[model samples]
Target: MWIKASGRAAMLGLKKKILEQLRGAVEQAQREGALPPGSLPDVEVERPQNPGHGDLATSLPLRAARAFRVSPMAIAEAIASRLPALEELEPVTVAPPGFINFTLRTRWLQEQVHHILSQGEAYGDLELGAGQRVLVEFVSVNPTGPVHVGHVRGAVLGSTLARVLEAAGYRVTREYYVNDSGSQMEVFYRSVWIRYQQVLGRDVEMPPGGYMGTYVVDLAREIHGERGDHFLRLDETEAIREIGEVALERMVQAIREDLGLIGVDFHVWFRERDLYQDSAYQKAMSMIRNGGYVAEREGARWFVSTALGEDKDNVLVRSSGAPTYFASDIAYHYDKFLTRRFERAINIWGADHQGHVSRVKAAVVALGVDPRLLDVIIVQMVTLKRGGEVVRASKRTGELVTLRELVEEVGRDACRYFFSARSADAQMEFDLDLAKRESQENPVYYIQYAHARIAGILRNAREKGLQSEEGDVSLLNTGEEMDLIRKLVLLPELVETVSATLEPHHLAYYALEVATAFHWFYDHCRVIGEDPADQDLVRARLKLVEACRIVLARTLHLMGMTAPQRM
Candidate 1:
């Protein structure tokens, strides 16, 4: 009763009505003596895998043979007999072993097609994640070298996840944590300084642990152009500091551009140096010490992470007074939890960082924040293959491939789609030949082609003046068209599920299905026909095609792909 009266309750009422209808139908069958009074077991209704099975199938009788104390066939017949034959069901059948198969009203699914057309690209959006604030931090690649194909996956995945979260109604912040204070950055600094010395007529050998990438020479050239002869005369550390800042900024810019090619933007660029220099680290040290998480040994400070399940105690501050990376990270989390106050902070890291997970989560927990508030998503490593040969990348050995090179070779959409097409936990191989040669076969292009094809159809239809009519939706009965409409209707449910599970690959898969549906529908049905009788029907089909276009456009846009007007 309350369900019928309240607007919000109306949604629940529909479900209750379903349960009530199933139960009443069973009870009435008992009164008619069609079977024993309680012959049918509890009903279980779920959407069917194949559309021919109807909107939902219930196999309760099969699962409850012992409880019903009867054969499954008898229960299926009992339930079938008692229920009012739903008009939505084409021909409800009872399979052997008591499976109640339903065939949904194609008209209802067809009607949803218009809802999407009316809703435009916002069709699948829901309010499930409203008012929730989530922080997604990823691709905070150390400011050492340019991005590599290895770094591209995390950026694409993180950006895509942030977009998915937003569509599901959460206020999501996409962030990049700059690792400017790390040892790798120092090596990069030294590498550039050595190149700077060489540019200044000083014969200097490449430092043992220096960055050997071609970018080092480019950075030195860039430094030379701007600072002239004066910058070359300074001491190594001083000159490196001046030139390193410029080099780091250039590197960050190059990184930003690489991400921009794929449509990812960070809301914040939290500098790691800020944690150390801005008292955030000191404040965190004080809190952790008070909490008994920090212990001193031989004039050095250590965070007793071993007590918190780490393999060993990690040094917070060394005897020479330099703070370790772990110490700065502790303070970063402290500020993130105590100051930024994200409901949940999700950090996407490579598989190599799996060992760092528990310590970070523990630090958040140790700082009085809920342990569940911190989430670490470790995306597995990516293997790069060129002509079936794996490209071995190592920054220390300077065997790495920069991300800009990958983007330039394969393009951004293909790069993002390929990485996000599989579960992050699964190791992926980036095949250069496949990425570059057969661009049309790329999943991103396939989906984009759907949108572009639809746009072309719409263009052709409009040119023919095929003014769409809001005709009776019942006219839509084609199998492929119905399948496509059904897929569109379930998109909202898919979004909710994908958001909750954090398996963004589901969206990638859905993108492929949606495009496939469009392709099938487009091949079979023409949106514009010359026959007078086919005009209104053609117009109606136009509406459906528009709905598909909207979905395809948004889906590709979310994946950071362009919906080319003409592919």
Candidate 2:
């Protein structure tokens, strides 16, 4: 019952137990008058950097020393003496200058191998979110072209973050904010119209700053094949309008297909046009205007962002009476916060949108929402690599690399893994040759191979009529066995950490560590021993292997990658 309750507490079971003990000890010490107590600071626990120190450590005594007017070592002694016994932890230690260290019992770590097997796929599931609703909007490239390589990072990051949040017990909505209105859409419409004319053998020049990708030509050809010059007879205005609607639909579909190639999907495709419907845009503007953040200067509507500590004012609507992209963004967030009423809205934007973060948060504040509820993550650009050279353009299209092409080359698993291998703020280099490699040099292969190896071992045990369910896990006392169990138990903790920080890259690194640990255990230990006398050891090791498999599979799934059963 305690294990089940602890599993729901996000599997920081030992760490949490230590924290509880420490807090209780502090209270006991204060009541005993061994330590002067005003209100104690919040007790925090962390894993020590060096394994020799302990499994988990806390500097609560040091943090509370000044407030209590006592030396940290004195406080540590007082608390450590008062700490109640826990079966999962060995004797607690107090280090110099006041640090309380806890080492997990070896038998307790061994028992977790069985516990993890009981959890199976749900081993890492946590109650950290407690069912909070979160909306993660990402990879909202304009519906004017196919998704490019530059957009893949945020797509993978946002999708994986949504998954992690779900594992942490949060109800999450994945959305794509389609920029299907305003000047960009007008340009897109004009560009598609010119391309359609070219497809129809008409002599029409493309407007300045028009799309030049070969996909546009392909779109034009498809439209010609479908419509057969019917739009050619319409007046130029009507033709552009009709063709633009068709083009936008096709482009949005193309964008969906391209993103789907890398396993990115959205629950909602929120069009910018929707913001203007039912005077939603006007209502959003009115909220900001009433907050006294809107200003009229030189025939333009400006958001007085300087009033909210912004370095300069921003245009909400131009002198020409057209709203700026910033205005639509404000309306969009108003929908997310006020209309939809998400507890939190996380926007994953490209590096180019970094400067817009503060303004949007400022606008949220003016709209009577807490600025902290809006989190804007700026994902840096990605550079594709082959061998040692930078990959700039698609060889077939002679344009920037498309997300579809990247997926085709490296595959969906590698695309997700490599895109999420780095923090969102760091530019990543995706190596084509390495991603395709079948050897351990590739982390994707290495991690999957660990799962595959466990699968193979299980298959072998079944052929030999072995039953791991009856295994005595107490026999698993090897250093490598305990070490691997340590990694297996970290998944719930990882989910909680990533959910709080909104960073999914740590999952990649943790998967690799689990793989490395499994590899080491496999190298040093034999699962199915040849001698009949070693059957107990064989069964215990089989249980360990099975636990490792569940952990590896769960980790891979969270990263949006496949956990192959066979290499």
Candidate 3:
């Protein structure tokens, strides 16, 4: 059920209108002593899951029955009797036992076409976020190699979520956490050094457990091309660290370019080394220690997570006096919430980090920050297939189909649409053949075709001297026209829901649904009628068609995909 805040009353949709009416009715009942004068149950209005029930349903009666010492049906009758008559609602009634149901007026639904046209590209923008500051961190790949297709899910999900949040009125900051300090980074650097030596006419084997990627050799060749044998005169320590930094920069640059191909840009690139170099790591440990959650155990500093009901305590620093990556992560979040003062922070991690989620949440709680403010979205795996055959990847050996390759194979628009068309928690299959198809079987094609079809209609209408903005939208009373308007009116609600749930997959579903509704209306109705008698209808329907185009374009833009005017 949807709850309406007072400030958002003017923007309430049909469902929220019902919620407001129910709230007014409850207040009236309480004033007249029909119910107790105390805290009332929350007013929530929702679309009925089962279509036959009603357009909107409320469980206010069931919630209030126990509190008011009355049967559920009696409470519902009392509330229903006091409901004010409104033109926006039709056939307000009570269902069996407790639920209150209401259907929206068809005229109101048709009028929304004009509303959508008036708003244009801003039709679906919601005020749910109310400008709260939020930071979303994702695709913080190890930077040991090129960004692979394996990181695509979190990258797409996080970037789409950021866009949706911004649409919902949040001040969003997209961030990439650079893992520049750790054992993995050390191995990568040493591997690059060995590759550099091999390119210098020296037969050197790569160190055990170092990077075996072919890209490593490429990096070495690139360095040798720039600085021919100059590094050979330097000491081993200085050469390893300096050469590794150069290689790391190249890898990170490659990652950024690949992400740019898919329209992902970060507002901040936070380095992990900054945590220790800037004393932030010590401050975080100090805060946890003052919160009484830190203790020395087994020659190591532990977080004492067992006190929070965990079965085991996790070490923050090892016995050798080196801090773990977990410690750096705690410092990172501390910087996000306490230093930068972001109201909320979201981290999109791979499924392999599921165990780390609870540990991080515990750290947040122990650091005196509310754990609820931090959200960790775990993105599952993605399997790429071409003609039903699996495409395998191995980032360790650099034998991987990079994200750039995926974008190039299917085009940027198709790649973003397909990657974002599923939930992050759900494992997805990217089928290359279907994505390349230009028919209705491809969803991206189907949606883009609808937009293009509407564009063609509007173009023909203009050539016939019909002005879209000059049409009287009130003439859009046909069932198909009403259906398209209803679908257009749902974009705001979808934006609000996705923003609140931190789920952007709903946008993909809503885009397809909008495309389907527009196609249905276009199939049944003609916007350009040759007969002089139907000119008014043609003009009015052209305006409606233009509104559909606005919504479709806005939807695609939100998902970082293109809306083709001609296909």
Candidate 4:
């Protein structure tokens, strides 16, 4: 039997459908002159934590009540009465305190299996952005050393956010801002020079606060191997400048390679030196001065942040006549918003830089752009554990744990998944033992197992001459089946939520829910059996399993984790 469009309700997704129903109800009430006329606020719909309340609950009536100057319960009742009949929705109910709850129709729930299969990997994509340009700059670690685990969280967060935005229809640019020009770069250069002299068996005092890691020694050895005793012929000034430039490039390349170990690559490696060389810094400073946001005090150029509600002014240029990092950052952002013309700019910084957030936004506002268009995500530190004991630093490097070592230890999938398993704002402890384990206790294993198990089921079904394209979706009516279908349908809405809120950690939680739903469905519903009378049921369940695979795979891919067909 063919499923007709008239019989199968069109799914606009649960949240969107509920919002439409609420908005339509208000419009209908207005048409009938049953309530005061006014535009409704953006309806916020979410799944009720307690399922008994309803599938989705909203406080739109309470919000609208204020605008219309009426009792919330009365407005809710009027809105409920005026709701148009929707096949996907059973009915809208008014709860206490003006909450509107909506339940899903059984047929509509069952139809989602078809919808998921029809849409496949494209099912969860949303149109929330509608093609806005969003530039996400993250893990812009200074090119002084290798990328350590400290940088891992921000890299994962930014990459996942970029993926989420792309799924939500935003034109995204994954970027890395290279601090290639600064005092740190000079320090790194001198560090390398000192190591070069030491490596050549010369008496040289190591600079104070120089990089002392084994990697620095390795860099010196590399330079020695390439040009033995050649730097001794050059003057100190020439050697410092020439060798520093070479070491900076090498360090940046090393950082890039390390990031690649964990599946991070940037569309643009924006160099800080470019901002100065291109005079973007001069132009930005002039713009701020023209806007009266720049002032000179005590021979130092200061950003007058008090006008933007800051308690004190921040220095842009020091009295010694050298521009501070803050000055370069202002220019970089000016290029981001005005030069590059990105509608929105998102910077992912370490938690230590949280103080810079307000100041940068103040600078953006002073540069004549909306500060709201700039978003700063501060990712807290991550602590790693091995065998229930804290692993503060990598034993091999004798310093912070390099992201490469973490990936080599737990594999890229585990590293990416575990690093992104928590909110960027929250500090997390990564269990090295659990990550390396191949048990269901590990979440990556658990989620990947569902996909692998479904793969096995699909293979068995194929050998038995069963296919979802020929299956009858109506055969899926079990409670477990409906619950799984409902969970699968929530992915698109979840993407929308993450894109709006800039939180990809929600994907991690949602993936676990999907995995749980799949596991539950598998336990209660057997997909393949030899019984001739149950062939239709077997075919339908196979289709459902395939749909689950699509969602599971999409979620994993979105988080930069692999969806393994075999574990």
- 550: Cα error in model 3, Å: 1.3
Off by over 4 Å in 1: 1-52, 58-102, 394-399, 439-441
In lDDT terms, how accurate is model 1?
Answer: 0.78
Q: What would the per-residue lDDT of candidate 2 be over residues 1-567, giving only the tens digit for each residue?
A: 657657653248667777888888888888989987688798899988888888888999899999999999999999999998888889989998799888888877887887788888888898788899999999999997888888889999999999999999999999999999999899889988999999888888888788888888888999999999989999999999999999999999989988888788999999999999857799999999999999999999999999999999999999999999999999998999999899999999999999999999999998899999989999997788899899877534428878878888888998889888899988888888898776767788888889999999999999999998788999998899888988887888899899999999999999999999999999999998899999999999999999899999999999889888788
The alpha-carbon lDDT assigned to residue 194 of candidate 2 equals 95
Best by TM-score: 2
Candidate 1 residues 1-567, lDDT tens each? Answer: 432241222222333455666778667766777646544555667777876566667877677567656688887787776767644355668876578876656665676665676667786676777668999999998877777778888888899888888887889988899999877788888888888778878888987877888778878888888888766677767887888888899988888887787677899999998887788888888998999998889899988987788788778889989888888888998878787788878899999999888888878777888988787889999899998998887766666777777888888777878888888899999888787765675677788788889999889988887766665566678988898886676666666666787777887788899999999998998778778888768878888888888877777766777787877
* Every model's TM-score: 0.88, 0.96, 0.93, 0.93
Alpha carbon lDDT at 365, candidate 1: 70
**Residues 1-567 of candidate 3: C-alpha lDDT, one tens digit per residue:** 222232322235555666767888888888998877666678788778776676678999998887888788887988899888767677679887899987767766666676777777877777778889999999999999888888988898899999989988999999999999888898999999999999987998888888898888999999999988877888999988899899888988888988999999999989999998888899999999998889998999999887877778888999989889999999998889888999999999999998999889888888789999999999889898999999887655668888877878888888888889888889899898888776768899888899999989987876777776667777888778876876787778778888888889888888898899898998899888778888778778888888899989999999999888788
**lDDT for residue 399 in candidate 4, whole number 0-100:** 87
Q: Residue by residue across 1-567, what tens digits does model 4's lDDT show?
A: 212431222334445556777788888888888889888887888778988887888888888888999899998999889877777678788898999888988887777888777777887876668899999999999888888888898999999999999998899999999998878888888989989988999999868777778788899899899989788779998998888887888998999999988789999999999999999999999999999998889999999999999989999999988899999999999999999999999999999999999999999998999999999999997888899999867534438878888888898988888888798888888888898886867888888898899989988877877766778888888889988988888888778789989989899899999999999998988889879898888878888899899999999999998887776
Q: lDDT for each of the candidates?
A: 0.78, 0.89, 0.85, 0.86
